[model samples]
Target: MELTYLRTFREVAKWGSFTRAAEALGYAQSSITTQIQKLEESYGAVLVERFGRGMKLTIAGEALLQYANDIYRLHEESKEVVSKQSKGTLSIGTIETLAAFFLPPKLQAYRRDYPDVNVVIQPGNEPFIIDSVKEGALDVGIILDPPFSDPELHVNILREETMAIIASPDHRLGELSEVRVEDLESESLIMTEDGCTYRAMLLKVLKGNQVNYNLSYEFGNLEAIKQCVIYGLGIALLPRITVAEEIRKGQIVAVPFVHPECKFYTQLIYSKKKWQSKAFLGFVELIGGINHQNH
Candidate 1:
């Protein structure tokens, strides 16, 4: 029945380990166990259960968690409205490229306008970002992806960002003004993580053309990918904005490689069910200016 107990339960569910939840909440592991026990007593059902190496929610635990999420959301909303603090944390989840290149200016201005509000930036994959928003784990998200929509979240398109092929300035493919799919036959390729939208697009195009290629390198970090391309390890496909400065500095070249599927956009998203606090709206407005300017 206590709010803190529900919070502890949520944390336990989030971490899936009593020890981890305790560490994250700055409590003793025994305290975490006590809280989970208290929650089960209040609800009259067993909650979490062991799942191999970790823990998972029991059927009753899953049922309570859904309501727990709503309760937490509503309590935060009540605190914001009743107390009028004008202060809260805005947790934003974004992919690495947008975190580095697209959001800095907008987030800077957002901070200036809402000096009391704290911002937490979580760099992660697109699906994780979307899932976090839906779960009320993140206040908002910025991502570079193709036209996206979810019944649980509101999607706002920032702008269309063209995909480009990047390679060392002296790579053989750079000699051509435009690099066609066939032109890359048997060529080495540096790639981003497997599920990356741009990486998937590149592979789909090549497969459609039946162009055999080599996966010379696969990297989870953008800097590593760029460095590999710079060293002539292989050519890579990525959003153009990510390599604009490198191309300008002559560290890399953006080869023209256009495909319909390669066309993606920067987008802002938030859960439709979430209560928009004043700080949240302020941040959205700042990002809106970027959306307007880019049009």
Candidate 2:
């Protein structure tokens, strides 16, 4: 069996549509259909069936998918090992918060230590980064806590981050060094969008305490939210790492919540089945070493 055929089949099985698989693989749709047809002929068995508008795997297809996954994983592992012997490249994905605050120095050290290896960083939100790694679009990801639940992915705890309720120096709550849930009842809250884990946790805590406050605004970007808060638009609860400079410059005041301190774990996430290359392993080790030094 041709390896290309198996690869195409794997893509189809992952996405459930030839069109989607072709798009993801950057192959023509006709090429994807041809590959599947050729594979079916070689196996002398029907592997896929059309269910409604989408494709469903037959028992034979399902069985083949399992083997295909294993084969692809092994092939990738072999490639990584071989390429690393020649000193190749590594790809890493990370969310914006880490990209901005935590990863720069580590990445700088990585580049200095492994001048022969190329490291690429792709930054996005947690969900986007996790999906990219699972789909083989990226080698690894650094994500914020409340880790992704995909069984195919592996997660390693990197560090824990503390969140603080912050406001402009002139804001009403800025004078207080520490605040309770009840103290926030009269203030408008600015937060990230619904998909943000930190935002969800903050809301859950507030709801549990029967604390009601107006949601002044929601933003996807932390910088924008910080700007809004800096201008006294509303109070925002955000990671301390993200707002440390502002606090130091006296632009904002950070007030820790008294009960149920808000904390998030940072994790390193990657496809469980991926072959760990030398460069990839080195990057992981670098991150681990940095965390150890910090502690």
Candidate 3:
């Protein structure tokens, strides 16, 4: 079967619409239909069935999708191996904290060593990054510890991270050696947006202990949250790595929160079934080197 036809079929299966698949693949709608027809004729089986305006995968289609993923993955791998040089884009998805603080030095190292490899970093929260990695839109993802696990994903625990309640030096909480969730109930808080993994974890723990607090400000940007905390607007529970520089500069005091659940993790996530290119493997190796030095 033609690789082009299989690719078109995968896209159509993904979106459940031939028009959408055509639009995504930059093909005419007629081309998509013709490719699928040719593929079906070659295989002598119906791969997709139409119900009204949408399409659903038949058993054959479902099976083909599995093979299609493997076929495309190996095709890319073959190209990378034959090229013998890293000259393609590496798409990475991550949360803001890592993008802002942790990844810079590692990224700098990567750029210096592999100047020809283009790197693109997309920053978002855990769910967005995880979904993008699973969908093959991103080659890899750095995500906060998620509440649940997916068997299809290969997750490497980069580190167990410490999260603390931070405030400007003169803030009331700064005087305390350790703080409690109950103590935060009466305080205004600066935090990441609602769906953030760390935010959700903290909220879940607080709810379990019946500790309620006000979200004075919500920011998707870690720097903005840090700035708000530094200006004494409100206290924030943030990863220690993100605020290490500020703490060292005496701009903020990171008071360790007293809770078992305050511990978080950073993970490197990728699809288990996806074939890894040499450049992708190189990046993963770089990450390992960085992690080793950090510890």
Candidate 4:
């Protein structure tokens, strides 16, 4: 069996979807399926079983997955050892919000110090980025709100962000200095999809207040949600840092909650067992130093 097939199987098992594995590896779905099939045939055992729209590993598959993880780790370590003798590259993952608002300057500094080091930036949502880091797909991930229950990872708090209610300038809530949760009962709301940290906080707050508001839409893309709110589709709750420029430009109005305040913490997360390259260490230092200096 090819080592590549084992790597593919590991990725598929980690994500629990052939389609997702294909996308992550930049392979066609058919190619991923064929690779897994060949691996199974060679072993004379089925590794995965279909479960709803996704797949779940059989008992044998789970055992192989454990071994696969260790093999992949050793593979990465070997590559790092050789690369250090020559040169090295850093693979960093970040959420869209940080990629847009915060990462550019840090990246510039990183490139300046290590002109020969290749830097790869993978952008995705919080969960995707975190999962990639946990699975050894990324060297490090800049994420918003640390994962709830992962003891194998280390998280360094980067910044604190406030959550605010946003609306177009002409919306009824826009004219208010502060609005109670009850006042939002009749307002149309646009929210991020489930699994988003902000979405969970917003729902908890609304539920706590016994507020029954109208939810018009749910989206995962920040820009799409912003555009919808800009066009007066509905009000939205999001991080203050994300809407700072829009609020300043008078494109949107940000209002504080009268009874409850919501906040989010941004963090730099990485696996505790993963080796941190010199380039990754430099970038982390740059971010930490700059934030400290400013404070």
Candidate that would win on TM-score: 1
| Deviation in Å, model 3, residue 83 alpha carbon | 2.8
Q: Against the hidden reference, what TM-scores do the models get?
A: 0.95, 0.77, 0.76, 0.78
In model 3, which regions exceed 4 Å deviation? 1-68, 146-149, 289-295
- Report lDDT (Cα) of residue 141, candidate 3: 91
lDDT of 2 by residue, 1-295 (tens): 4789998898888778999999989999999899999999999998888888888889999999778777876787788766656256677888778888999999899888788877788877778888878867678889886544578877778887877788999877777888778889968999898777788888887899899899999998889989998898999988789999999999888887555536577888877667766676778888882233322
State the lDDT of candidate 1 residue by residue for 134-241, as single tens digits.
999999999888889898878888889867788898888778887778888999999999768888888898999999999999999999999989888898988888
**Candidates sorted by lDDT, descending order?**
1, 3, 2, 4
Candidate 1: which stretches are off by over 4 Å? 289-295
The per-model lDDT (C-alpha) reads: 0.87, 0.81, 0.84, 0.80
Output the better candidate (1/3) by TM-score.
1
- lDDT of model 1 at residue 72? 98
lDDT of 3 by residue, 238-290 (tens): 88888999989999999887787666777888887666766777788888622
What is candidate 4's lDDT per residue for 59-137, written digit by digit as tens?
A: 9999888778778777867886677742466788887778888788888987888887788889877788888888787
Q: Which window of 10 residues has the lowest lDDT sum in candidate 2?
A: 286-295
Q: Which candidate model has the greater lDDT, 1 or 3? A: 1
Ranking by TM-score: 1, 4, 2, 3
